[model samples]
Target: MGAVTSSMAAKFAFFPPTPPSYTLEEDEETGKLAMSGVPRRENVDVVRIKTKRATDVVAVYIKNPSASLSVLYSHGNAADLAQLYELFSQLSIHLGVNVMGEAPMLPYIVVRQVK
Candidate 1:
């Protein structure tokens, strides 16, 4: 397989679960945003959740995926949550999954990796 190519301005890049969709960019300095001209429209149900595992804390944006939920996580100390948000969204699209996220909100979902 070949390496993936992305065109986003965020620290990280994420694609939707579906093929030929939009990208999400997370700017450690400037929150997050969905890249324009994606194949699918932005769904209101998409959610972003901040989580911490063991001594590592990160953020994951969960999209509208039915089979397996796609997750976009940032490097532990690479950048702040702001930068990760956008990239997380884009990552999901790249992986062919919907996205769910929260921008500075409560009622978050915490997930633990069991492996």
Candidate 2:
């Protein structure tokens, strides 16, 4: 039973999804992280929210969110903001609704010592 369990776990342990490629550069003057390669819309505001777990995540919020329902978009494990930024911007414009899209957080891995 132990061997079977270990084998099963091993299959998924290292087989995480491949995330999209993006570059984040901090401005030397403003000290703000510049998002490179992501499409930008005129009205949408890029903001960062800190989670209760002490992690910060990036989000794009359409203008005047109080007037409409917002979409809390969570990208798939294998994807990142760079790949979906354009899609989110289009959705907000075409759908005529406020859209808030968030980047995926890093997965938390737990290591156990097998005696």
Candidate 3:
């Protein structure tokens, strides 16, 4: 019964955006990753980290010059890193701290991990 309930829950739980909100592009000269349609910042970096689960997670790192601490922010399910880029930047500026925003993988990735 528990297994059946878990299966049903998994089937209905994830709803990643169909076309994806943004795409990652590598800068030819700098060899850095950036999100499409977002302004590139000198202090911000887009990175992909490989997890032990064999999945790659994309994260945005914002640097504040005077900041001594950092915040790891996980955005809501409804949004992706591109959608929250400005917010993360502003938060780092106002709070005077570095910010790292982690992006959620697509639904298919999550489903595959479950299996």
Candidate 4:
């Protein structure tokens, strides 16, 4: 029963874009990472962090020189980093705070039945 519920929930909770919204690229010379088709920003950095589950999660960090606070923005399951890149940048600039947006990992929520 729990398995069936989990399966149904999984279907509704995740909606990864087909073909993916963007691809990660690394500069051969500088070793810097960027998302394809997104304009490069000197204040923004693209990084990947390894989770305990061994999943690599992509995150975007936007820096503001006047920032006295930082925010960790976790987007909704239906959206990806590419979709919210502009918002994150704007927030960092207008709010004068650093913004870090963590991409959603569907596999991070794999449902397990308890014994």
What lDDT score goes with residue 107 in model 4? 50
Q: lDDT, candidate 4, residue 59? A: 87
Q: Which regions of candidate 4 deviate over 4 angstroms?
A: 1-14, 104-115
TM-score of each predicted structure versus truth: 0.30, 0.58, 0.73, 0.74
Model 1 per-residue lDDT tens digits across residues 1-115: 1233333423254321222222344444445433324333444232344456323233334465552755534343233344445565566667767544333322231322221
lDDT of predicted model 4: 0.77
- Model 4 Cα lDDT, one tens digit per residue, 34-81: 876678999999887788978767889999999999999875456677
Indicate which candidate wins on TM-score. 4
- What's the residue-level lDDT of 13 in candidate 2? 66
10 residues in a row with least lDDT, candidate 1: 106-115
| Model 3 per-residue lDDT tens digits across residues 36-57 | 7689899999887778987777
lDDT of 3: 0.77
**Residue-by-residue lDDT tens digits, candidate 2, 6-95:** 999877764434543455544456544435566545676655568887876766666544436667787534446666677777787777
Relative to the unseen true structure, what is the Cα RMSD of model 4?
Answer: 9.6
lDDT of each: 0.39, 0.60, 0.77, 0.77
